[model samples]
Target: MKTLSKMHGPARERGVVLLFCLIILVVLLAGGVAVMRSMDTSLAGAGNLAFKRDLVNQGELAIAKAMREFNASGALAATGATSNNVAAANYSAVQLATNAQGIPEVLLKKTDLNGPDVLGNTFRPTGTPISGSGGSTVRYVIDRMCNATGTFASIGKSGCVYTPSKTETPGGDQSQLATPGPSVPSPPIYRVSVRVDGPRDTQVFLQASFTKPE
Candidate 1:
């Protein structure tokens, strides 16, 4: 029988296991770093969304204040008040000029808080903020949806957007039939824009248009 002999033609591979282990370690480290970065981005996005939602909820306060001002018995609806612009009350009888964003130019003019806008039109005074706390402030402006000032009759139907006070509609009795009522002139639609400034330079703008009967 031929004698079996150990033939070592080349040096046995050394540190092969060590090299394999090092490569695996590097791959795992890279995966871990990628996962950590993804987590951070998700956390930041969630935080920003939460802040925005909270700020929007706070805008209800401004809406309530505007409703009060337009109350039939309130100062704004009093004799001669509705027909004229009241700067102190932050109200305008005519619609104000707006920017490309549809945001009132007056609200964008911060250099002079109460100065005129880019069109040289007087800024409707925002007056004092309706409410503020914890680095948040809420303010609003009201404008009648009309091209000209004065009573709705004087502005003519083409100059303003309005609806009659009493329109034929279904009553609250759950009946589908229409209920008839005499049509009477109602106040023109008024737009209220609320601005909320919050922490981290976050700002929210909201608008609501409504009509109040005289």
Candidate 2:
């Protein structure tokens, strides 16, 4: 019998084993890469959700602030010297002017906290009486008062409404008389509405109604 050469026999077998080990390493590397990619995608989605939740919270706070201002302005009162409930009109007009003028002052009027008449950017509905808070990324309208009463109660009518157009939706209609005994009368109630654009073409709406404070 012929003796087999040790180098040709065992050495060749060792080379084959080395090749198999290399292939296994390559496969593990590919699997690791896939896992890493999946993790990255999950992280991105979580980040986006967190950002959106933050925006919603900011919007809700903005509405509350606007309600406080509306109460303070005496604009929501039934008997006040300058109680026009024209917050929506005034703010809309100002915003229109700013959009047309492209002046920093105009934008600042609605955005600046120290501006003369800090609540100048509020939106007041005529019949509904909506108010708003400024200085937020998204604009909102909150109505704290309404002029409706009697059998045709206007409790549900009081709330917020989003107005992207130059012209906003008018608030609830007031009753001509008080105490709808023979005829329907309107009493003053309150409403709050909020509108926000998370991004271009993305809009959200929120509305609520409250009884007028005694």
Candidate number with greatest lDDT: 1
Q: In candidate 2, how many clashes are counted?
A: 24
Clashes of each: 0, 24
Model 1 scores a TM of: 0.79
TM-scores for all predictions: 0.79, 0.43
lDDT of 2 by residue, 1-214 (tens): 9998765434334478789999999999999999999999999899878756766675675456555554645344334312333443222211211223332122232333111122344333322222323333555543333232221132232322222122222342235324333322233334444545454344444545444323
lDDT against the true structure, per candidate, is: 0.74, 0.42
Question: What would the per-residue lDDT of candidate 1 be over residues 7-107, giving only the tens digit for each residue?
Answer: 76987879989999999999999999999999999999998898888888888788888888867766596755767677777787778777778777666
* Cα lDDT for residue 59, candidate 2: 62
Stretches > 4 Å off in candidate 2: 1-19, 69-72, 79-136, 143-191, 198-208
> Cα deviation of 26 in candidate 1 (Å)?
2.2
Q: How much is 202 displaced in model 1, in angstroms?
A: 1.7
